[model samples]
Target: MGASRIKWHVVVFLAPAVLVYTAIMIFPLFNTLRLALYSEADQVRAFVGLENFRRLFGDPNWSGAFWNALGNNFWFFFIHMLVQNPIGIALAAILSHPRLRFAAFYRSAIFIPTILSFVIVGFAWKLILSPIWGIAPDMLDAIGLKSLFAPWLGKEEYALTTLALISVWQFVGIPMMLIYAALLSIPEEILEAAEVEGLTGMAAFWKIKLPLILPSIGIISILTFVGNFNAFDLIYAAQGALAGPNFATDILGTFMYRTFFGFQLQLGDPHMGSAIATAMFAIILLGVCVYLFAIQTRIRRYQF
Candidate 1:
């Protein structure tokens, strides 16, 4: 009777959260997958199976845009991995220094941008980088580096890179805070032992702290991967549905948006959009699975 009562208690406790997740996440995900299997024609919806997928991959008209967006998404994710994560780790290391002063102030200042609205960050940076009547050029001129100032957001070569950097500036704090907490959780006894062994300063960080925080770093990396691939709002807010300068800033999210909702003269095709979304889901799922099954396993083995 007691065991049965305990089982009921467990169910009661878990039921609400499970229901909420099913309704919001599971249902929508499966529904999107279902939608991808059907196509609308002549005001009639019919089963298309993998036909949409073939069109997306094999049809030149769609394939070109699809590949371009996928490539840009990779670059965006790469920039976050290359620049943002490293900067975040470095900042976390600096801020976690035992003797550091004004640590809270610095942390709060850096993290404040993370909480800001994406629309605000995108538009504000757009205006700041505007070639005319913008502060970026004026600031450069004031510093006697006027010749170096160019309209970064207006150039196809630079627009994606510029937005990537802006995204880095906003979200770097997340990794920093996470890593900082991980650093703080290191047992004092371990540090004392390290100090006794003369593993101080950079030596201590490299040899001692780094290995201990590897799990945290791994978590942060996967989180960044998921977040970057799902990214849309900032690009849309900054560059519009077009994701211009000549679609250079186009990522999967914006591409999916344009396909799903239609823009300007383009007709909306929910079937194609669902296919794109499914592709995104598959990509993200693959990445996460790789991390969990391969990278995470390696990390655990190393720690052990």
Candidate 2:
């Protein structure tokens, strides 16, 4: 009877959280997926099976925008993976030095931007980059690099890449802090053993510290993937709903927003918007599944 009562208590404790998660997350996700299969026309909504998805992929007008946004999203994510994570790892390595001075201050200073509102960061960068009264040009002029200065935000070729770098600057602290914590968790004795064998400095990190932190790096990679794919607010705040320079900076999130909620002259489209949301959900799910099954499996195989 006592053992049975323990099982009951466990279920009782878990029930509330399960209920809340179902109500808030699971239900809405399934509902959005269902909504994606339906369509509205001439004041009526009807179940349309996979027609919407067909149109999204097969129709020329829809395919172009979808592919463009998808490509840009990939590029945005690539920049972060390339520039942000490596820089974060390097910074974490520097900051984790046992004899480093002002480590706490440096950590706090680096992380402060991550805590600021996305809107604030977006607008702040916009003002600083504005060609008319901005300081970027003047700063470049002072450094004898004025010839390289241009209205990056206004140019199609530069806007997306520029925003991506700004995003990297604002969010590098996340990977830094995460990797920093992972590094600090390493057993000092293992590092000492590595040093005893002539594996010191970069050799120590490359061999000992890095292998143990693979799991943490995997986690950061997936998180960056999800966040970059779902990103909306920063681009919207900086580039507006149009994602302008003629939609050069438009990504999945902004595309979905503009599609579903209607922009300037476009009509609201709940069904089509739901389809976009569904596609985004599928892409994220596919990525996470790939990481879990393929990448993590390989890592574990190599580790063992």
Candidate 3:
């Protein structure tokens, strides 16, 4: 009787959260998936099955945009992986040092941008980088490097890379904090043993600390993947829905938005939009599965 009452209590506690999640997340997700399978003609919806997918993959007009956005998305993810994660790991290592002064202040200062709205970060960066009225050129000129100043966001070759770097600046604190916590959690006894073995300073970190924090690093990497794939707002705010400089900064999110909601002269096609969204979902799922099944397994093996 007591166990039955406890079970009832658990159910009662969980019911509201489960209901809310279903309403907000599960329902919309399944609805989008369903919408992707149908098409509208003369205000009448019809079951088109895989026709939308075929159109997305086979139609040159649709496929070109899709592939462009996808390739840019990959490049964006690559930049975060290449630049952001290493810098984050390095910052975490430096900040986690016992002798470091004002560590709390430094952590807070670095992390403040992460809490700022994407719109604010995007617009602020755009203004700072603007050649006509921006401070970036002035700052470079002050440092005797004015000749290197180009309108980075205005050029197709530099726009996506510039935006990727901006994103890295905004979110690098996350990986830093995660890695910092992981570093702090390492037992003192292990450090003492490592010190006895002459693993001090950089040697200690590379040999002793990094190995134990591999799991945290793996988690941060996967989080970066998911976050980068879902990225839209920053690009949208920075470059508008068109993702211009000839769509150089266009990613899956902006593409989906443009297709789903219609921008300027383009007519909204929810079915095709949902198809694009479904492709994004598939890509994210595949990346996550690979991480969970392959990379995570390897990390576990390395740890054991």
Candidate 4:
């Protein structure tokens, strides 16, 4: 067959996916961006240009909630980086050890939480940590740290962090699985050579395995960035629309939901809601670009 005909086959195979993606993904994205440009007038849509953007950033009432949600979202991402990622790496390292017994069982056991629904996971954790339930306090008392067991979810000082920790507890499996796959992809012969060179055990991991897996870890970090930024369901399930304890857990997702759908006494503002979604899209895009051009380019992956 001619090159044109051959290329057409590739096109044919990809056509279904392209159509589906365009209908479900690209169309909605551009539609939202389009919506951000318009305002409702007389129950009709009117093009408002950048007026919505200005209102989002310039109006005190809107700006306060926007900035607060943005800040809280960043903190949510930061907590995952500091706590969830390191723990996942540690677990992956342990699980990837050669000849480790029950590694499969252990991985499955740990990953079970990741497959659970957000509502189920969030509510279960909420109940477990509820002070009235006394489960958390009992565990703390058993460990002689009962004094440290405040009603974390109810206290504004700790609510966001508490919810974040719960999120981390649920999603750590993703990073662990990703890192484990990366570790397992390393060649046995390469490791054997490292051993021959007297780079055994911890030395081998530091000198060889870690460098190889840095790229994978980088990928995991970017994925975490995307997931955390788009996150809203868990926070919603655990904290409700207000994200109370005085809105401490309010992130972009919940904020957008509240703004779009109208909650409590507030009226729904479609123009502003579209603007918020646009902002979230921008934030996620910016993060992905930074990862790609900044951090990702700096990470060197060695071929086995």
Candidate 5:
């Protein structure tokens, strides 16, 4: 009787959280998906069933922006994978060094950017890089590389990559701290034993430390994957809703916004917007599933 009562108490306590989550998150998510199958008719909603999705993907008027945004989104993910992860690992390794002075200061300095508002970082970088502001040009000229400096964010060839690098600079701290903590969790005796076995420096790191930290690296990789896919605020703040110059920096987030809210000249189409959102959700879900099933399974055997 007492055990049953205790179970009931646990259920009662947990019910609120579960209910709230179901209502706020899961419910809304599923509702939005359902809404994607609908279209507004004379301000009254009606089920259209895949018509919105077909139009988004098949209609030329909609397809160009959809494909463009999706392509940019992938490039954004690629930048984080290629640049962010390696740099973060290197920073973590440097931070883990025993002889390093002012370790706390370094960690705090590195992480401070991650704590700032996206609006601040985005606008600050915009001003610094703005050709009109001349900061980038002046800094480049000081280094005798002024000719190499261009209005990167304003150029179609470089806009997406520039925004990506800015994001990497701001957010690399997360992976750095995570990897650093993982490195610290490793037993000192393991390193000492490796040194005893004539493995030191690069070899010690590669052979001993690297293997042990692989799991943390894996975790960081997955987190980066999720974050890059969901990214929006930085690009939107810096580039505006249009992601100009002439949609040069357009990504899925900005694309979704444009579709949902409409810009100065374009009319908002909620049905198509919902379709785009559904597509983004599907892609993210697919990535997570692949990681969980394929990459995560491979990681577990190597973890111990």
Candidate 6:
């Protein structure tokens, strides 16, 4: 028999996607890395190695902002991880019940926020939460909880966490849907067997369905990490470029934007911006790598 020929058609089919990805993602990533390695002086760009990074970590002026923003970013992510994902899992569990009514309607309503523009969501929430001309205080008063009402967005102690909660409200549907899909994909036979074995209800879910959905949960975790780290639009729209009330809501994304674009009197520093971007990239990459290696590897995929 003659030797089999290589499949040229496969490469042809992939060429367009590859080219587009390279142009939009890979090229920009490498260019940013390259930019991070250089320093600009007197209209001259020079390769200065890790000086920008050193300044980011060592210099008090830069390090303070960098660390604060970074810490806020982590807190933002932690809220979503703790509050959002657990709520999503519970909601998904409830919605995925075979006997549930209006599942479609509920799903659509829950997911509606995810489709809304960040600008609309941010601005709308800002107005709704505003002390002046906002309905929140009135609604709370109606329920006899008026004292709980505060200008959450304006308070430094509450701003970041409140924004994080708002983000959670908008994005919880994502993890719910991912988990719901994973749950639905489980075979009827397995669930039936579990029921027969007296493992119905929450017990069945914890023993059987939960393990099966771990992969999807892991994927959602990584995605959440990436998304939170990359988040900017909502904060920018609601809090402005400063991420104020004393920069309490400042995150890596907004920090990078301010550094790159020069907010107020501060001059734009591309190298420093690139350094921040690189750091963000490294953090995300490290997270993905850890999830893939540590979590995914440990989760056993069952074939049914």
Taking all chains together, each candidate's TM-score versus the true structure is 0.93, 0.93, 0.95, 0.94, 0.94, 0.94
What lDDT would each prediction earn against the true structure? 0.92, 0.91, 0.93, 0.91, 0.88, 0.94
Task: Order candidates by lDDT, high to low.
Answer: 6, 3, 1, 4, 2, 5
**Candidate maximizing lDDT:** 6
Candidate 2 regions with alpha-carbon error over 4 angstroms: 2-15, 301-304
For residue 138, give model 2's deviation from the true position in Å: 0.7
lDDT of 3 by residue, 1-304 (tens): 6644567777899999999999999999989999999999999999999999998988998989999999999999999999998999999999988889999999999999999989999999999999989599999999999999999999999999999999999999999999999888888889999889888988888888888899888898889889988899999999999999999999999999999999898899999999999999999999899989988888753322
Provide the global lDDT of candidate 6 against the true structure: 0.94
Model 6: what TM-score?
Answer: 0.94
Name the lDDT value of residue 81 in candidate 3: 92
Which residue ranges in model 3 land beyond 4 Å of their true spot?
Answer: 2-11, 301-304
* Predictions: Cα RMSD each: 2.2, 2.4, 2.1, 2.0, 1.8, 2.1
Judge candidate 3 against the unseen true structure and give its global Cα lDDT, from 0 to 1.
Answer: 0.93
* Candidate 1 stretches greater than 4 Å from native: 2-15, 301-304
Candidate with better lDDT, 1 vs 5: 1
Higher-lDDT candidate of 4 and 6:
6
Q: Locate the minimum summed-lDDT window of 10 residues in model 6.
A: 1-10
Model 4, 1-304: lDDT tens digits are 6655568768899999999999999999999999999999889989999999998999998999888899999999999999998899899999999899999999999999999999999899999999899999999999999999988988998999988899999999999999999999998999999988899988988899888989888888889889988899999999899999888999999999999999989999877899999999999999999999998889875755
lDDT of 2 by residue, 1-304 (tens): 6654567767899999999999999999999999989999888989999988998888996888888899999999999999999999999999999999999999999999899988999999999999988599999999999999999999999999999999999999999999999898887888888989999988899998888878778889999999999999999999998898988999999999988999888887888888999999999999999889987877753232
Worst 10 residues of 3 by lDDT: 295-304
Candidate 1: count the clashes: 0
